[model samples]
Target: RSDRNNAIRSPTSIDMDHNDQDEVPTASLGTWIFLVVVAAVSFWSQATVTEERFVPALNVIANIFNIPDDIAGATLMAAGASSPELFSSFVALFITHSSLGLGT
Candidate 1:
């Protein structure tokens, strides 16, 4: 058991041991700044697109289907929130034959 523990604590194994606090690694300040800037830009772009295009498209869809605005919005929101998980589950069950995505 001690030999196993020593092997795990060896230099090469240090990289694989996530629980070791003494050798914690982190991204550089520049990398963190770049990530923050990229995230902000992405969020801004998504918000702009949703405001300029998605809302108008949703309105048009509701009008075409004669769906109440609230109902259409609720349905769209629910579908948007669930579709990724549903697709992942299908892929996990059928293509990958794994339960990982279902658990997620």
Candidate 2:
């Protein structure tokens, strides 16, 4: 059986809702805005927080780096999320510094 996805022509996605009956452009515009905002936030999280769980973080950062002047103003959003992880990793690293802690 052929894959359903194979039928589609365009490989990349750009959200464009087309229905001929109603030509209200507002909804489509709103969709674009939402996508853009999400991409921006994705960019910031990935870019700034150089922590280990940096997959999503990197994606968000890439959006910012690759895109135009388009990062959402809240740059610290990802850093805020990363604080707990960062703290824990720091503590782990500290503990690992001493072999004394390794033995019960």
Candidate 3:
């Protein structure tokens, strides 16, 4: 238990002087507007493509991989529903190069 605790306490996670908090940056109105527009476009494009193409493509991939029909249907359905989230995650990682992107 003690070793587990020690392992989790990285240099940044522990502070002897208690001065490790990050200051939030304030964005301008134009920046906020731009962020909103970008997010809206991302969501809209994801939805449009998902509805028109993602399911069919996923089916093709599953068939090519020789996945069982029963399991493939369920897996593809779940992936289809989560496509937006997966797309956003990739875009965030690319844009911010961070685990989590800038939150709105």
Clashes of each: 0, 6, 0
lDDT of 3: 0.81
Q: What lDDT would each prediction earn against the true structure?
A: 0.85, 0.60, 0.81
Give the TM-score (vs. native) of candidate 3: 0.38
Model 3, backbone clash pairs (residues 3+ apart or across chains), number: 0
Kindly indicate the candidate among 1 and 2 with the higher TM-score.
1
Clashing pairs for predicted structure model 2, backbone only: 42-60, 43-60, 43-61, 46-57, 46-58, 47-61
Residue 22, model 3: lDDT of: 54
What tens-digit string does per-residue lDDT give for candidate 2 at 1-104?
A: 35665567354432344455686556688899999999999998866664555446555765767733234224445666667877666666576664343332
TM-score of 1: 0.56
Top candidate on lDDT is 1
For each candidate in turn, the TM-score is 0.56, 0.24, 0.38
Ranking by TM-score: 1, 3, 2
For model 2, give the 10-residue run with minimal summed lDDT. 67-76
Candidate 1 lDDT over residue span 1-104, tens digit each = 98888876868677676567776888999999999999999999999987898788888988999999999899975776688888988899889999767666
Task: Identify the candidate with maximal TM-score.
Answer: 1
